[model samples]
Target: MPKSLSNSYSNNTQPPFMLLIPQEEWQSLHEKLDRLTDMVEKTQRDSSNCDWLESEEARRLLGISPKTWQNYRDQRLIPFSQIGRKIYVNQADIDNFLLRHRIGEHR
Candidate 1:
């Protein structure tokens, strides 16, 4: 059985750590964690042999809203990584995304 974090300390004024997650909230937390895990695995699997770009650079290159970029990742259209709250992506992934989505050609 897993130990509950609610009993961190009884003698300290500000116990090192304490968590009191309600049972109802566990499901929501579980779903969010599952999504995060999927994102992590996708990034890990594609982390080789490509130039990496920051989220800002990729968003600017694509000229799309942050939400759209997020949608792309959620839809498995791109692989990315999150480090300290910032996201990074491989240049080749972005290029392939564009090529797969090309709707016009230059003459």
Candidate 2:
């Protein structure tokens, strides 16, 4: 572990890093980043994903009022979450409810 030997090893170690990239690969990376940026802006403007819906949104989707939704929640007929004072519902639960209570049996 002499200082000269250590210095030589450090100099020869190549910084443990790389910047290897073909022209096509760099273009592809740029394209991916641009698409990601566009998606982020679109999502910020209008999030259509059910995962982003709150309780009120979920109720609206069900064509019901907040009070009725609360009743359903209280009755445990629907799955929901309470974080502190905020209530939330899973879109899957809403879909499952519709399917389970739908009319007409299979042929």
Candidate 3:
């Protein structure tokens, strides 16, 4: 059975200096943690790579009314991130969004 963390404060005083983990389980856990760390790092890098436009600027770029922009954001039609109280939209995300929603039949 795996040792309990509470064993640290138990009357046993010395407590268990180390806990034993199975070799396979340890390797699997380490790999999973590494993958998670890589994903987080990649996300941070990508978020910082693009030029993020503030709400007003983004609305102007999209040629939409502030209300309309708010509507899209509230409906999740737009992708954005909030820093403190400010909202920022990634330029690439906006471009991709527009391209994805373009009309199929043009007049």
The candidate maximizing lDDT is 3
Candidate 3 has its poorest 10 consecutive residues by lDDT at 1-10
| Residue-level lDDT tens digits of model 2 in 1-107 | 56765676655474344688999999999999999999998986764454545888888889998789879988999888889988887777888999998899689
Total backbone clashes of candidate 1, pairs 3 or more residues apart or in separate chains: 0
User: How close to the true structure is residue 31 of candidate 2, measured as C-alpha lDDT?
Assistant: 100
Error of 3 at 18 (Å): 47
Give the alpha carbon lDDT tens digit for every residue of 1-107 in model 1: 12455465454555355688998799899999999999998887777534789988999999999999889889978899889988899888888989989998778
List CA RMSD, all candidates.
15.7, 6.7, 9.0
lDDT of 2: 0.81
* Model 2 CA deviation exceeding 4 Å by range: 1-52, 105-107
Per-prediction backbone clash count: 0, 0, 0
Q: Find the candidate with the highest TM-score and give its number.
A: 3
In what order do the candidates fall by lDDT, top score first? 3, 1, 2
lDDT values for all models: 0.84, 0.81, 0.87
Give me the displacement of residue 78 in model 3, in angstroms: 1.4
Off by over 4 Å in 3: 1-50, 104-107
Q: State the lDDT of candidate 3 residue by residue for 1-107, as single tens digits.
A: 34665554656556446789999999999999999999999998987876788999999988999899989999988789998989999888899998998889877
